[model samples]
Target: METSHPGTGDLATRATEILRELTGRSDAAFRDGQFEAIEALVKDRKRVLVVQRTGWGKSAVYFVAARLIREGFGGGAGPTLIISPLLALMRDQVAAAERAGVHAATINSANATEWDEVLGALRDGNLDVLLISPERLTNPRFSEQVLHPLLTGGVGMIVVDEAHCISDWGHDFRPDYRRIGALLASLSGDLPVLATTATANSRVVDDVAAQLGSDTTVIRGPLSRDSLRLGVAPTSSPGHRIGWLVQHLGDFSGSGIIYCLTVSAAEDTTRALKDAGWDVAAYTGRTDAEDRARLEQALKDNALKALVATSALGMGFDKPDLGFVVHLGAPSSAVAYYQQVGRAGRATDSADVLLLPGTEDAEIWEYFATASMPEEADARAVLAALADSPAPLSVPALEPLVGIKRTKLTLLLKTLQVDGAVDRAGTGFVATGAGWAYDAARYAAVAEAREREAAAMLEYEAGHVCRMRFLAEALDDPTAHDCGRCDVCAGQWWDSSVDAAAESGARKILSGIGVPVEPRGQWPGGMEKVGVALKGKIPAGERVEEGRVIARFTDLGAGQTLRGFLAESAEDAPVPKNIADWCITVLSEWDWVERPTVVVGMPSATRPVTTADLASGLARVGRMVDAGNLQLTRDPGSPEVNSAFRVKNLDGAFRATAETAAAVDGQVVLLVDTEIGSRWAMTVAGRALRLAGARAVLPFALALRG
Candidate 1:
């Protein structure tokens, strides 16, 4: 005998009940368009695109729909597969699923040990939902070993969280998300697919919808967050911005985020805030995974005042009562600004959103905007090298062959892999033997679109128009209207005045410079391939001791002055009195084991005067012997390159002068330079000094560039 199923109306009613249970609110009904999206997925079995504001309950739609489908609402469908962008997002969704009585598991980079168990649960039909990062979809191990079997078994529905990332035109375009289109194509026609994003303009929406299917249903709600009060706090300098944050951060009611554009900026701000007695932590891409988890928890629990962070903290960090979101520098695009600010006022009646635009923001934006684009020459070089290799080539192995930097090379490989031109095999990358064509037109279009978005961001900072409405229009929100709570709409709500004492304190911190210059412990891999005998770790006796620099090339204080002085157009000249004084201050603060008895200068083809003057000034101040400059065996023209290539280029580039070698024997030497780029010059020169009988060498530079 066949069993009868419940009616469509009954299933819809059950979804409401599930929502209430999940939210723990008896009156938790689906928001205006939420039920419609759920119904489309559960009953109609159609692909859906949901463009809603944050805190508008998009996750609820998918979780409830997954439960309804698994309960036989759509022919007793299999488990739902959610493609999440961030690990934090996945954790929150998994917890939400459990509260709704849905068995959920996640396979991500953070939980390698749990992957097998998660896969087993999925294979046994013991899970109602499975979440995985978008990047995991492209991993060969997962694609061939796990994903194939899961797809064969059939997934009831697929959800793409932060769907804007799928579109190249989106502000946060991620190459990994391109795999989602292929995944969608491989699924059955009737498999319900849902893509959700809080930030998407019409262009991104059309792009994502086309990726989903031509007949996909898009349900876009108003982008306005009435609870958010937007404002821009324009400051004359970075110090002023820091002062304002120091003075006003505590006035906010709850924990929040302070977003910075660069990792260094985030670290500097965190340190300054902490020194001022604020409980804060720095969160960036370089933060360890374990630390990231702990910091995320601290922020969620309100243990810290704010997480001074980069974009790494964006996307899917849930804090229901987050009091504010402040940007130390403006994002390059209004779409990104909206997405980050959306993190606030979610589950609260009101929250503050402020922008503190910096002068260097544009420079930083320009660097990042063009860094990830696939250059035709670089792509062709990568492909040619891979084709020549009989076996898979590791990144280190391919670095010298392609002559492209590691970071850019990795991004290029990922783009090619997603385009079916490459594959990852075991420990290395192999060409797929598939014919690939470079999409030059597409990349050019993306570049142009980015330029436009950057311009839009500048306009946003101008604050000439209603801030909320401007963002809404940028996202193509049809209901764009003046959000009366914004500074432009109703006047500024935040105090822009900086405290005098705070400004003085911040100026002191920014001006007092000396960043540690950690020596490279190991030689770059694959140096043997380049005819260099060096490999593995550097010998301790020959290695340069921990050094110091005046500041990073991107620093806010003396860095600005150094950048101006060291510009390509600037003439080589003696060190300025102020910079020389600062150098002396740094040396005085140094806690070296041995005081330098001599100062030796590194040979600089471009800035010889600057280097020689720096050496003489330091020697005079410390009353040490002024050793002559190291002679350059060969002039390696300044070439923009990575570590392996840099090391290869600088081989035999410098030699210790006879006078310097004899004078520095059995004495501590300070190796000084105008600026350090790649640090290969210092490494090579320091080794020469050590080989010449110097007891120890401490590398010093005005600026350090990685």
Candidate 2:
């Protein structure tokens, strides 16, 4: 791929030609100065990073530049390596390009044989562009065995899409992105790299530049989209806001997405909407890849009218006809909200981005903030489990040791590997088996890092400054145009009395003397209208005596007191912290928060519990009783060991005796206890009990007997 006077004529001519072909507009037609700079850079062969928004012709910029490199230089001499973030995205790009007459192929970890073929094609100068992910490139084998050789021969350009991933400050940061700078240097004989992203503020630009080892040519277009109408709704529960969604959906013509924080919430909403006779589907991280494929196809084909999903559902998914995007859960930052809502209004016609504010959004983010990391003991347990297993253990298998969410667990494992605590082999991770030694100092370092990140997140969430300004500052862009599209921008929607009532309720519960509750968004009567007012404030006339409880404020005894229907009826205990966290969120959003509390955990209370608890709890109960009969008399401290006891074969007499003794008078109700699975089982049981009888039946014990 050799050319003469590379800085002048040939590169410019070819870039113009490609641009004309793609947009049916000549390079001269572009009034934006980007093309001139791009033309100059292609001739000088400098690394470039272009920052723009979605629907802006950013991809067209690279597509044209790549062709210039190909045509100006000799044929079959060098190839362009485009490091994309995802396989689906890579495939989509390749297919889209192929449709437009560009020869491109994907090389990812999942397709080694195809990767080998692609590498061979590149070596033979048959490939014009090769798309791969950063993860694949980081594999030493891919770098040493493939990239090093290709670049040494002669490679023209290296392009990184979604360049924001390189920034640690980005909302979606990938650890592998840290190596992209070094990767680009390796791929093109240290050739000039051009990075492109749909979203990047000044902070991301610096990070992308530093990551690419070049000063980025940041071409930031306006973030504003006049065609998109941004609206914020103050609702108590996401469920209640469905009416808003229904109203909008009825008014709108194109497809829509309702983003929930949890998989179950997505499913529940999908079901509820379906019951109401809406053509909708649900998507989450757990949705099988095949299902996602079908869903995407359905979306493209207009077979599905709407989709209820978590954040995982729509990445790299392109749907130009999308008209509405609903936030079933509150997002932690404005940037995230922007990205999700930006999915709609892809074309020219106006689109609707609806935010249904619920109390749980803050709490969900806090859960991630306070999520426990694997301690030294936990690491040891995890290592032991992995060491004992002949095969690699799935994350679920190690749940007993690392009690955390799957996403956090994955990141933790990655951190451990990077820190040399474990070695990854193929898809499964193998314990290094270096030694049984646990280093307190090393553990402290990791803990400190976790705490620092958590603190940063907390600050970002609770900041009183402009959301757009905060995002801009984080992105390293010191200057940012004020985006008047946020909760703070909209004035208080609640009434003064409601705000005062909310504050009084919160002060009644959480305040000591004069300290007021801090609210999330602007609320009337100061902090009174803020959802945090729901935390400590009790509603007037709300009282509890025995089983019949009076409800004034919904926040009191949130996770502790069980509400009973009648005096003789058994009361189900209060919603758990996780569930209450979701419910209070609902109340706060609706101005029903007599007392609002800052979100400390979980995203929303509307998220339903799972079924796996029934299996585990039933098993534990059966084992304990079986062991008690077998004389395995062990202390209660021993979780694995059970104690055996002997009793007279009396039933009614046994009950009378048990009732007469003060110590034994406690009812042996099958409470799920404060377990993750317990909440789910209780949720299921509570629902089942409502449909069945008033008799207190031991749900799990019966299953164990069965």
Candidate 3:
């Protein structure tokens, strides 16, 4: 039952006062639907879902509700709990809470040392708001020790920020977010809950609302941004796109973001832009947390012209005055594209939004879109292995037995843990033997939905209909109407013209190639379990020296050429003369500790001619003795399996020829291959050569797959 508090009639006045204090503006007032949401939570004690556009003051409603409830507006409720998705979002919310005098604290991975302090504050009832990542809900310690007690004791309010992630129908579905449903179920009936997101379509809306409750009050506002001028510019190639950005990034006003499809693309674009005198930086998952914070601050302070980043910088970045957002390639779905572009024109009168569609966008999308779903066979293997284990099996220990990559394995385990089929013990993951059933139907439906979204994205790029209207309809926005500001409606506001000089410079930069191939410093986990007799740091004597590759398979430069050569349908042929020349150039430019006196080829079951030609060409040009191919005692087939299985498969597969061993005795040896997929081949072959008395092995490959 809803509880009535004193001065319920004055909630609007009090909320407005709090809003003014939070905004530091005397005239601050609630926008349309904002006061209604605040009143629903504070006075009516009702659950609410607010699907307002970004910069529409969604945070204001929750912050005001928390303050009112703490001040006995909701009959003396407990402190509010917020399940935020990102550390960045938590930091912003905590700061905003402080400004509003809400006394907020956070528990997340980045601030582990402060967790105790935050917990103390929570116990003391000194915090009005507590923000945490959704992943924390699944942590054994956090759930049993903290969350359970908080739920039992009573929370005044629960907020799921970026609530779209809670639904599989959402564009950015995170597995950890599935735990929110359980958290909601544990709460008392009278407690208020709020779920907020800007990107959810009608399907996602229904899914999230069902998770919230049957009585959830959803308030969805217009999805269109009036200040955004959208446009799509089709590029002929990756180089042309880079050239376009170099030429026209300055044309947009103020600081902005240039989105790339992959981390390699982000780095390449950053380098090319910097070389052409653009002040920019690359942001991706590979960036360290400290560096990420620093770069984010730089962008906020307008210290950089733009941050060329992948999806790592997509959500929860609050830059109200961000002037523009440009996509180097289209995202797989209009929902995702709209969310990214929403960051712009938020607190500005106008911001330019441009999409430079690339020729390889679909290929990149296919690579990432299907990576998260767990295969039935892999899931069953994990369950059977765990069921047979005497104790919890860590991911490494299970890797060899299951034959799944570590990254994919971890994701699968998390899914199972959430499904109640697995539990995390001190040692590792233990099977609960709960008779877990694979939801093949659900997974298949999700996959089909993704394909449909991909097709819709292609249609959006084609621009047959109004871009804004297309996106609005895809989002199931009821107020779908053509915005007169986009390129289609406004007759091409963006110039598709390219600068010749910039194009030439970009082509030259892309052509200049050499990617460092860092040697594997340690054997993958579970190699010992696979009977490989290896664990921990690789012996220095058996390790290959730092090496170089012609380019990454994801590179914008020679990547297309390399991809065609390595295509499954392409016949195995000798290494092309241009690639051979590039290989020679890479060797000449190498700053090695010692010059290689002999070159050895890695035996390839599929591309023996290409591998042999590369080794012989390098040996001839570098004037090094040709050590010939390392004899394959037993073919490992292809290095397409996980690390543990790959190492196991390659064990005792190669032996250095007697002549090759003698030729390389006490001398540096160069190891050449047409391509490096898992790098296991080079590592195993290098170990063989090192054991055969080669002083050192330097690995070189035509291309490195990211």
Candidate 4:
């Protein structure tokens, strides 16, 4: 039987003091569920799971519990350990810990130079709280040398923030979290644990609860925000959404976030909003770490009107006064949407939350949904490769043999390790020979769950239900009720019109073409170890020139149009006229140091017309000679893999005829493709032409895909 604390009045009074100190409010007191969570951890010393909305004092519970446990106020001792996914934002948490008079330290990538110092502090008992990231759990040395000691006795309580990740993305890309979930379940009962999240639905909640332990205490509350006024604006196209933002941004009271589904959409929105004279910045995965920190501070300072961002800015970014949140495209699940919009209306009396639904959202959703989950064949191939290897093989070395991309291969290996099929050996992996079975039934169930969540999102958009109530119900919130503040109940509060001039300008910005394709400066690492006969930098004399493409495949204007023609289901037809025209337009604007005098088409088994038309048309318009084709010796493999695999996949895949070589000799040659994905295809083709005596190679394509 689980031990229950007999008295809570003393613990609650002491907890109130810590809470007031943490929040800097003399009158501050625990919310309805906060005191209970703290008392359970501090007095009862049992596992506690708190499912509450953001800004409901989840962090306060752990911070106060750490204090009480350290002070022996609840018959407990030792430091508190927090595993947060928001590694980059750990600094803010550390600062928050200080305000409560608790000494906190963290060992994360952002503070790599201070790891030794932080670890020392932990061992010396000078630190009251230690924050860690889930990704760090993958490091073998840290787990063995550092984490092992702390879990043995140094940690009094453990807090898992954004705990839904334990059962959600953990199953897909983050195997470390899944493994940690198992580790947490095996913890000694006397060592208290707290798991908290604002986004978990009933399904995710149950999954997390099962991992925590059977006797875990669950404290759940209302997911709806009374201060939020939810609404959805009808916008058919990307331009219309951008135009709507440019026209109506002044209606909001203060700085906020504008969420985009993709990096390109964020950048496109940033440019459109900036062009229309709004103070904004783009935040995406590509944003530098330092720049992300700066942008977060700027947003908090209200120095900028908004930060147009992807999911990179999603969780753990706290700004209580955030005025509004507008989505350019809907997320795949209502739970995800609810978590994102929860960022707003936290401390404000009223905050605007709107969704501008796009026609392409479902397509983007399908693309991501497929990419996030690994196929069984890929997993089996990974295991087979590990079993075949005489020694441990790194992800890059394993990429070519297994034909799986490096990122996905790394994720798969971690999962295999967690599941007992493989073991981490230094930077590489070795087969454990434990004989793992593929959980096909579990994967199928997860797929079905995702589909149901996606369908619920569709219902949330147009089912005529109250928006807040729909989201709350989708999250399975027991306290959910119809909020009369939503657009469905109170009538639409935002205007749906876009300025015609602004719409045309946004279209122009979206349609603008000619994205520069930077040449690869060096060969990828671990190529020789994988048996690919290539190494070092491409000789300057044989390198391809800086290339150009009509647009990025993720761009809004020509990019979306390009997707329709290049989609998997679209046939191998002649190049679309609009695409050909865009190509000509991009070429006309090219200010090449030395213009090409000949064009060479790359052989394409799937897109012969597209390849030939682009090549012949460029030669025809530029008055350059057509140098025929670069023959395909074999399939070059998928261009979506990592650099090493991609580079090895294209080795000896292309060849040039002596006659075509003669035509290209001593002439600047224009290399053309329907799409310039990976750029390795062009790199290999260009090197072959250069080795055959072409003066220089310049690549041109309809779209650039990274």
Candidate 5:
């Protein structure tokens, strides 16, 4: 039988009976000390806070204690309320409670207008527990509609889920958390409080307690994920790091996420992965709502094997069975890293977090600093602009006058709001009495904080110590021990010991007062691929007609080399080595440059080559273009060609399949048959078109009116 320690003897017996009836296995995980803590809280009717990581079953701490309170000291039953940060979690908790034979109702944004039904359940004692979101709690109707009824009738316990949100000092500070304490103060004074979170440090614990406005009792367990093996790789280029990621992805099972620094990077990486034969999807703010929905569904169905996305992918929605979470760039803060990594390994499985650090990440940080830190003059100008406007100036309008980027201005506005200098009005800003006085000290402090975070990235990338230890320390868990599972403890299993030590040394170098030393050989490939392609090589071959040499372009002197045959011109004319030189000379002098691309058969030419053979025969087209091997120029001699080709699906008609629809974008094409008449035609840019119904134009534009 399950051993249960309730506040009173009668309640203890009832809880024991209840546990026996529910799970049939009743070993009391909570013993003498735990029982005493709850009994004292019940006796004094004091608030309690529980701090535990995921998989520790933190929910049990409150529910068990609340059940005991209800049985031992209650006129009938008092409702235990839970304020969850996520609406999905609220629903999940309610379902779990219902399965355990406890009645729980959830009131959140989804059904905010109909929350009275949820309150009706709470007031009539039909529910043992009621769950709501912080947003819902702040609703004007909540106090008038629910709190008054519950407080006057009776209340057993109050729980704050994802309690770390209350920590304004932490990286993931939610502004509404500041109001939670004030809201709690207005609730029934005698109601006991409980807070729970999967991830928490000492600072977060204090924040949670302070936000509750109660004498919070913290119950912590060991912070250990024995299964996860953490690793960090140092790279200088985002592209090279992505190549490394491609090499490692084949080893893991389940889905994965590759985080990019920008929306363009995310899309480019997704495309590269797809071209490399991996099924990939991308999610960014720029993605249309419809595409995001489709991609999200595709991820859940495993139709898309991986997702390359920005930070927007984290919110509580996606719960894929992720095998790994790879950071293509350094996260803005340790809190962001923890939250992103926490998405994996949620269930009884294990997942690894791979960090690829490069100069790009550092450069990105520098860019963020440069972009976000406005000049003192600009800040003053922003204040002046706001002062002049009667109504709050929209964010876009203030950008040109203030000389700061919109995002940075938003950050500044938020900071000013935090400091009581401004208030947000709709999509604009309104100045409070607090003005933007020049404070060098404040500027220094802000800059130093950002620099410290950048230095932490350097430390994480370069440290030879256990990565999990580095992560724990970065997250403010100073007492964290070596997990015996991370790369360092495993003897640099996923990374090079030499590289790791080099990074650590680099960090030390930066720590010194003088100009930081740029350690030679720190970056691979020495420099970015620029001016010339180091691997560029063009093969030489002799042209022949009917097994005899037709023309010899060999020994064409310095700077003039035979790259490839452009055409077999009806048994005449010398092939031009430089198309641009030929075009410039001909088009400028004769007003025409015509170069044909053709192949001669074996009998007709010394060597016969098919188009198929020549397609990849060109050694790196991009490199050739870069090296001026293949040149382009405007041919003024011939008017710019204007023509359109219509792709048909075997019926000699404009109708196309989905595959054909996706392929024909940006190409000049004709639309006919079931669509608009041929007279209303256009040469559209194919890439911008979207598919609707069975067909879409090659280049999308406003429909032609016939």
Candidate 6:
């Protein structure tokens, strides 16, 4: 191959032409640092790091650079390999590529059927850009069959989007992004690389840059967005937050997003808004791909007022004129808050951005913050189990043995895999037999860093300082200054008081009962490995009828009272009069096909008085047979264990005595518990009761947790 690089002026002219094509605007020109990033990759053949605020045309830099490289302006004739983190991002980039007249395709989990066609396009030299997800980098099949040839043979340029995710200090816990560093290191030589992010602080940027390359060119800009008017709406409760939205969402100009910390919150918010005659949909990680596409299109088309969503809606969906962003609860960190709210006011002059902080935010923050980092003891336990196993063990099989929940275990395994302590063989994990020492100091430092971040977030919500400047300085923006548009910099702009009618409606919605308790249809796999003989589907004769919950532990209604009674610090006592009334109401209003003729309490190792009182009260009030406590024949052990382990722990813990069996013989049984965490106890206890001759069993609880 011969070098025939285009002149700087020619490169800029061609890049501008592609930019106009991509933006669909004849006058579209490069924003500050955009063309420089493009030229650094195509002309200087240097690795570039772009740290700009949202909507600064970061995508244009890579797309233009890809076009230039493909046109042979930089002595390259290979397609660009963009390692994007999210599927929504890939969809957006591909669409933008087509508009720029670049033949772009993607290979990701969502497009498995189109992979062969996409690979054919790559092989035939007909593709200009090929986007892949970070997940693919760890796939053994994809690594050997696809990535190996691409990285070794040729690539015009490698683009790492949302590059902050690669940093150990800054992730919503994207363990897969660690694999990108390995991919960057394995490149043959001298390949142009680019990394881009909108919400990285200086520390995160440095961390990502160090992993990217020692010579990486960091082009950072001011983080403040002129179009965003940030504010904090202080509300005492979740109901007040919902009421605020129900009353004031129409005050905004156009469609936008309402961000929630969890899927349940998102769904609840969506239902509240819709019930108040607002056109909104709940979008979460649980949303199906097809529905997400549809809901995204609706919001883009401005057919709906808003999408109540979790973080799954961030990082990828682009709507140029999104009107507003409201947080139903405070985000765990400032970076995440900025990234999500940045989606608004991109192509518009101004957009409203508000945060409604909840008292529970700190608890939620602690949960998500510690979810990714592995503890030394847990790591040792997992490694020992894998090493001692005769064969590779799946997560389900390992869950009971290690005593870590599935979600935490999955994340730990990924971190371990990236640390060279484990490898995937088929559907299970195996020890890599490598010398892997747990870095306790590193984990501790990370925790301290998070604590500082959390403190900063609480400060942001307090609103004593300028909101925009606080966010900008948090990102280490050197040019951070007070924006005259924020609630602090300027005077308050929103109506902070909640409407009486809307507040009442919100209270009604919150107090509404009946969260269904889904019965465990199948016993967890590999239960026999833990000495529990359960396997396959639970027999219909042993399974409990679909159960009911008065409220979730995290709910804001009767749940507040329920959470108080059952809190770890609360003394063991019978349910309060108000909470008991709520429970009895739930039972009386239950829509079951058959009413229970007998009541039995699931024996509680801790809260025996509370559990027994509830069962006896319900039986006495409803005039049903009282069967007393299901005898605790064996200890149930710690409730922190995962499904298979928990089931094994509860296998013989409860015994349905002959007298208890006769009490409910051929009669429906209402099984009561103070709270349900794993639900394995409920399942096993109900099975015993059924085996002892109850015709049907229905489990009821004061609260449910996911």
Write one digit per residue (lDDT tens) for candidate 3, span 189-272: 668999999999989999999999889999989988888899998756878999888988889999999998887788778878
lDDT of each: 0.85, 0.50, 0.84, 0.82, 0.51, 0.84
lDDT of 1 by residue, 1-706 (tens): 1222546458768889889989999988888899999988988899999999888899999999998888778775689989998877887899999998889988876565466678888888888999989988889889877778778877888999999999999999989999899889877778899999999999999999999998899999998888899999774577889988898898787999999998778877886798799999888875544457678999999999999999998888898889899999999999999999999988899998889999888888887877778888998899999899999898767877877756678888989999999998866889988999989899999999999999999899888889998999998888888888888989978777788999888877676798766575667655776677877788987789988888876776788788778765579999998888889889998889999999999888779999988999899989999988988888765444445556777878878878888998999999999887656678878988888999999999998653
TM-score of 2: 0.60
User: After TM-score superposition, what is the CA distance of residue 57 in candidate 2 from its true location, in Å?
Assistant: 1.9
TM-score of each: 0.75, 0.60, 0.75, 0.74, 0.57, 0.75
lDDT of 6 at 271: 69
lDDT of 5 by residue, 1-706 (tens): 1223444466445545444433346664444334544554556666666654454555555565566666644332476877776544554566556544567787754443345566676666677888876655433466677876776777778777777767644544554454567767877666777767656667667767776665666666555455566777756565566555555565656777788876645755664565457888778654433345556667667677678988767644445466678888877666557667766666635787777766667666776665544466666777778888899877656766676645577666554555456666654777776855656775576577667766776776776677767667665564667878776777555633233433343333222111101111111111122212211111111110111011112112211122123212222223333532332232122211221121111111212232122212221221211101111122111111111111111011122344434333322221211111121111111111122121222211111111
After aligning candidate 3 to the native by TM-score, how far in Å is the CA of 651 from where it should be?
A: 35
Which one wins by TM-score: 1 or 4?
Answer: 1
Q: Put down candidate 4 lDDT per residue, 636-700, tens digits, no spaces.
A: 87553556667777888888888898999898999988887667788888999999898899988
Better of 1 and 2 by lDDT: 1
Tell me how candidate 4 scores on lDDT: 0.82
Clash pairs of candidate 5?
A: 2-26, 544-605, 544-606, 545-605, 545-606, 665-686, 666-686, 666-687
Best by lDDT: 1
Angstrom error at residue 676, model 6: 16
lDDT of 1: 0.85
Span of ten consecutive residues with least summed lDDT in model 5: 541-550
The runs of at least 3 residues in candidate 3 whose Cα sits more than 4 Å from the true structure, single-residue gaps closed, are 1-9, 388-400, 499-501, 504-706
Candidate number with the higher lDDT (1 or 6) = 1
